[model samples]
Target: MSETVTLPRPDDWHLHLRDGAMLTAVAPESARHFGRAIIMPNLVPPVVTGADAAAYRDRIMAALPAGSRFTPLMTLYLTEETDPADVVAAHESGLVTAVKLYPAGATTNSASGVRDFTRVHGVLEAMAEAGVPLCVHGEVTDPEIDIFDREAVFIERVLDPIRHATPGLRVVMEHITTQDGVAYVREGGPDIAGTITAHHLVINRNHLLVGGIRPHYYCLPVAKREAHRLALRAAATGDCDRFFLGTDSAPHPDGAKESACGCAGCFTAPNALSIVAQVFEQEGALDRLEAFVSRNGPAFYGLPVNEDTLTLARQDAPVAYPDRIDAGGEDVTVFDPGFPLHWQVT
Candidate 1:
């Protein structure tokens, strides 16, 4: 076993850096560990065009802490009204690295998302022709499907048909959470990959209900069962190029998340690596940690691996709960912040 290891710094293939204050508050956490992150475009008035992506990129740049080496890879939010010409322009101009497809009403700020895949045929064709990837939310929004079964159902109903319609299009199944999701992405063939989030590797549905409902563990494509969590761990650590890291580290203001109708998202920025490291270590696959966290993402994105390096150590430590960046507003706790972590960032 390798006593110590270092690898190219990782990038977050999927992330939601909300605009303005929230953006300013959370951008630094990711910047601290990642060299680049594919920024999600689902803002209030989502980034639907090249100009919007460019402007959002500028905001992310300005928000970065001084001397931070982080780069924000922008994406266009795909809506039914998205123009094929705009997608072509964005890809050609290099303003966007990918296009995000959120099934309408799937998650936060996704009300503007495309309601029907058939309606965006031109945009998908344009993206494929331009060699840009389509990053999907990958869950059906229909009310009848059980919350836990939504992803599997979407894979069979929505994603399968979409893939059939656009044979050459590159796709990333964002934040995959189920065995079915893992299996689907695995069988979907090349030019297709899935991003596994750090939180899902650590928490399952039992964590949500066992000790009474834990609101902080709530996230879109909500945590699945222990079996699914185990499946995610195996996929992330296994020799599958189809899976990699995407923290999906969304933040919700304390008021919004702790309310009667609590929002779905975990502010996992602070404890992400530690949580992921713990998972790999528990599976006796710490040696494979670097690949899942550092290598697979850039390989899928077709970007060169990072030159910088980071370390993870087998040290038991406690990441504080209610992470406070300011006074009196409210304390924000990461998904598993209060718990003791067996692996720590070095």
Candidate 2:
């Protein structure tokens, strides 16, 4: 017989609540499903300082619709010039939970990403001392390696070394997309943890190529083969304490997606939790869902688990995706948009 489980409310360890009108439009979807979220700092200009993080958090808070009890856990975007003192200041002010490291040119709005690992060693060392986490978009931005293999390469070439260099520093490999990434994070000891996105567990590379180029299926550290997807499901649902949920649910307007050069991201926030629940059920690990979504993230981040409670029932539901936000004429499609979701959040 299956057991019914009720657990502490979950937090999105990684999320992209873009600023401005998009922030107003998309913040509610995430807030409705999560008690708190670690908001991504990769905006157009990026949130590189503590003040920027605090201001962005206020914007996210304002965007949240009425009656929504969502807390935005902001992060600072790390750059080569990022002062180590700022890392300590941000943590001390309680404005940011972690410092996001996007290797230069790795993803959207990542132009200001750290140029070299050594450049930010000071910041990393400071985070180690402060007990703060360093959230990484773990993909090497080298031209030689095939796009699909960047995450795997980064694990061996960059992340491993960084881990060795900073012994006690806590690191979260955000939106892990490959089996190699999964294994590296799992075996790399307790100081290293990973955040798994909802889409990677449910969709594979074929989904993007099938039936023409599905732009909505596009995202950084792009989806991998079905075998990798299966591996991810196993790792996330498995007893590994290193894996947790981070729905890099980015919203791009339909226009940006339909252009000659399309942006890469999936607006999974609208249906993120349901997708995870469905994947867990399919993997025969539904009983472990609570830990993956709730306990593990906070435990890894050294934060108190929320007191709120949320329920996911095995029921059919539909999720809708708007072509664009009401405030702007932006154009892009969200992942799993307008689909019949198999799980419902209550």
Candidate 3:
């Protein structure tokens, strides 16, 4: 016998749909399941302006599969020189949904990220007034700080200060990977929310470092201790409206991932739903999966819940998933949860 659970078609609050060939290859994978996704703007040059967002949106739309209803919610990449007026105008005109803050050198293609947060104060203040949400990478790039401690240190130094300076700023702490991050968002008031990745819910530092280096499991705000992983799992499945799904499904060329200095991301878009279903079911919270994946994100972003639904069936046999996606001349590996997944998004 097979058990099934149906959910409102989910939206990925954080996603990276690279560009050109890569975009063409990966866009359909997400479109096949998700109704909408907050498209990342950290392109090589980055999507930093209204005109840039509009143009990028066109590219993304063209890349999507024919007749696909997947909507790409475009965002602007915040730099020290970002114009508050431009950000507000794009949001007002509906060309952009939010603005992303990547600390310089924090992650892939983030060299243009803010080095001095103060340089973007005006932009942040304007976003606060205009009701545009700020999606932050949430890790500092200080060389002295241990990689494992960056998220916690960032909370104490960068994020909290900015949030306090601009009181009404709606912020989404993207890809939060620490118990500290969990605590901050849980205690941080209504205006602040946190996004949990499908990979983070399943992997910890051990998953990344235990036997040997696992490049595919690496992501920015890298996975933390087992205790932190458990904290994230609880926050995701528990009764918290401020926490929701953000897979951060970044794709990298197979060579780029397996190189001497590999890229930091897990190409999880292909099997995100299956991985999340198993996690929620294990947590004994199947009733709440819809809220975490579908309802909460919309509630925080001021968007309506997706009207369509997708059903996941729990079958006797483990579902077989594709190992890699062919993109241009290279391959992008899909994330492996390191376990058998029985739920299939049918």
Candidate 4:
């Protein structure tokens, strides 16, 4: 016998649909499962203004699969030179949903990110006044900080101070990977929330380095210790509304990922929901999956829950998913969870 579960259509609070051919190829994978996605703004040159966000949004809409109802919630990249007025206008015009802050040199395509947070005071203040959420890449790039310590260090040195200085400023800590991050969000008020990626809940650092270096499993604010992974799993499965789903399903071509210094990301968009279902089931929290994927994120962003629905059925046989997604001529490897998945979107 097969078992099936249905819930309101879900949304991805954090996603990276790169531009051009890559965008064209990968957009459909997300569209098939999610009703909306908070599209990242870290493209080449970055989307830094209302105008840039609008143009990028147009391109995303153009690339969406025909007849698909997938909406791309656009964001602006926060830079030292970013204009507060432009951000306000963008939000007012509904051209952008939030502003993204990538600490300079923190992750891929972040060369244009904010180097000195103090320089963007006015912009942050304006976003607060206008009620625009700031989605952050919560890791510091200081050479002295151990790579595993960046997220915790960022919370101490950067996140807390900014939230204190700018009251009422909504912030979403994107793709949190540590127990410190989960604890902070659990203690914070509604103005702050954290996004837990599908990959983070299933894998730990050992999966990336135990026997050999696995580039496909690598991502920024890279996976942490087993204890941290267990903490993340708990946060996502618990009844905490502060934590929600954000696949951070960034895709990099096989060539780019297999190189000596490969890019950092996991292309999990294709099977995010399926993998998430398996995790929730493993945790005996199937009843809470809808809140993590659909309800909490919409509440945080002040958006309406999707009216549609998605059904996942558990089969006797293992589920099968494509190993890679074609990005123009190159292939972007899909994240492999190393365990058989039995849930499939029906």
Encode model 3's per-residue lDDT on 1-346: one tens digit a residue.
Answer: 2389888999999999999899999999999889999999999899999999999999999998789899999999999999889999999999899999999999999999999988999999999999999999999899999999999999999999999999999999999989899999999999999999999999999999989999999889788999999999999999989999999999999999998999999999989999999999899999989999999999999999999999999988999989998999899999999999999999
Measured against the true structure, the TM-scores of the candidates, in listed sequence, are: 0.95, 0.95, 0.99, 0.99
Q: Considering only N, C-alpha and C atoms within 3 Å, which residue pairs clash in candidate 3? A: none
Q: Residue by residue across 1-346, what tens digits does model 1's lDDT show? A: 4444576787888888888877887898889888899999989899998999999999999989999999999999998998889888878887889999999999988999888778999888878888889999999999999999999999999998888888789999999999999998888789789999998988889888797788888898998999999999999999987799999988877777788988888877777887787777679898788889888888888888899898766543564434544313545556664467755556
TM-score of 2: 0.95
Q: Which parts of model 4 have CA positions greater than 4 angstroms off?
A: none
Candidate 1: regions farther than 4 A off: 1-3, 316-324, 327-330
Q: How far in Å is the alpha carbon of 130 misplaced in model 1?
A: 1.1
- Relative to the unseen true structure, what is the Cα RMSD of model 3? 1.0
Taken over the whole model, the C-alpha lDDT of each candidate is 0.85, 0.85, 0.94, 0.94
Model 1 lDDT at residue 2: 48
Any residue pairs clashing in model 4, and if so which? none
Q: lDDT of candidate 2 vs native?
A: 0.85
RMSD, every candidate, angstroms: 1.7, 1.9, 1.0, 1.0
| TM-score, prediction 3 | 0.99
Report the error of model 4 at residue 133, Å: 0.4
